[model samples]
Target: MNTHPLRWDALVFGVLFALVLVGWALLTYDLASVDGLAVAGLVTLIVAGLAGIALTLRRTS
Candidate 1:
């Protein structure tokens, strides 16, 4: 029986989604420039990739 309630994977994914939503809102409201949003998106992708790799490794080990 599993006793833990908190799901780390879901939490990480939710955080990433929230970041995308925030960036989109900023762009839509003209609070951020397109270039800035692009950079932020790139950074987010990198972070997500790293997180995925780490999670995979953790699961395997």
Candidate 2:
């Protein structure tokens, strides 16, 4: 039997994944006119998006 505490539920992960997908879409289509700060934000978003994906995969496996 497994015994552990549940922190975030599936809905949370699902939302994170969905939001990251949206960020990726925005980065892809709107990167031409972004400033330096916007570039940094996009990079951070990419890293965070990867983290979200990895966490979701880890939770599943």
Candidate 3:
């Protein structure tokens, strides 16, 4: 039988994604405006994407 090695990148990505969701929820609840939600969601997604990209680059390098 063959098995694959454990990966930390997947774990990190999941954690970061979850954090983005939590942050967006909190921001939506606190701000309660379409504009606010849009801004918050955009920022949260950008930060998460950057983290994921950095992790991928690190692994490749």
Candidate 4:
């Protein structure tokens, strides 16, 4: 049996990264001011993507 973190981590990271874009678009609305929820969601998306990238690049050897 073989265990490698790379096998599943990449796919999951990619999905999360894609979801961030979708969340950003959906959260935006035309109005006088954007809601706090939208802003917070955007921030969360960015952090998640960056963290995912870092995790993926970590040495697996």
Candidate 5:
């Protein structure tokens, strides 16, 4: 039998992409205010930073 390692990078990219799409949809529908958008942007940045750190740690290990 053969096994393959999980693709964490692709998973992270997909999650981030989904987050952006959701934000875009909220803005399009006027469901989110300016402040909400700002918060979402900040959250996205934080998540990206964390993902970068995680990937780095994974590579080092």
Candidate 6:
């Protein structure tokens, strides 16, 4: 059985994943450029995105 808190956590994780994906895709698609602070932002997004996913999946296991 899952609680509301867990469900919310999962949702947040999903959103973060999507955000990171979009950021990367934007760079790849040439729709945006990531330089300087933008580079840092992407790195943060990638790490945070992976961590969020790991936490969400861990909760399921």
Top candidate when judged by TM-score against the true structure: 5
In order, candidate lDDTs are: 0.89, 0.72, 0.78, 0.69, 0.87, 0.79
Candidates, ranked, lDDT: 1, 5, 6, 3, 2, 4
Residue 22 of model 2, lDDT score: 69
Please give each candidate's TM-score: 0.60, 0.44, 0.51, 0.41, 0.61, 0.47
In model 4, the Cα lDDT at residue 45 comes to: 76
Error of 5 at 12 (Å): 0.8
lDDT of 1 by residue, 1-61 (tens): 8798999889988987898899889989999998998998898789878988999999999
The TM-score that candidate 4 achieves is 0.41
Best by lDDT: 1
Task: Compare candidates 2 and 4 on TM-score and give the better one.
Answer: 2
Where's the lowest-lDDT run of ten residues in candidate 2?
A: 31-40
Better of 4 and 6 by lDDT: 6
Give the poorly placed runs of model 2, Cα more than 4 Å off.
1-34
lDDT of 4: 0.69
Residue ranges of candidate 6 with Cα displaced over 4 Å? 1-6, 36-61
Candidate 1, residue 20: lDDT:
83
**Cα RMSD (angstroms) for every candidate in the order listed:** 3.6, 9.0, 5.2, 6.5, 3.3, 7.5
Q: For model 2, how does the per-residue alpha-carbon lDDT over 1-61 read when each residue is reduced to its tens digit?
A: 9997866677667866776676677668874444744676688779878998999999999
Predicted candidate 4, C-alpha RMSD: 6.5
Report the C-alpha lDDT of model 4 over 1-61, residue by residue, as the tens digit.
9986676678867877786666566667432234754676688779978986888889553
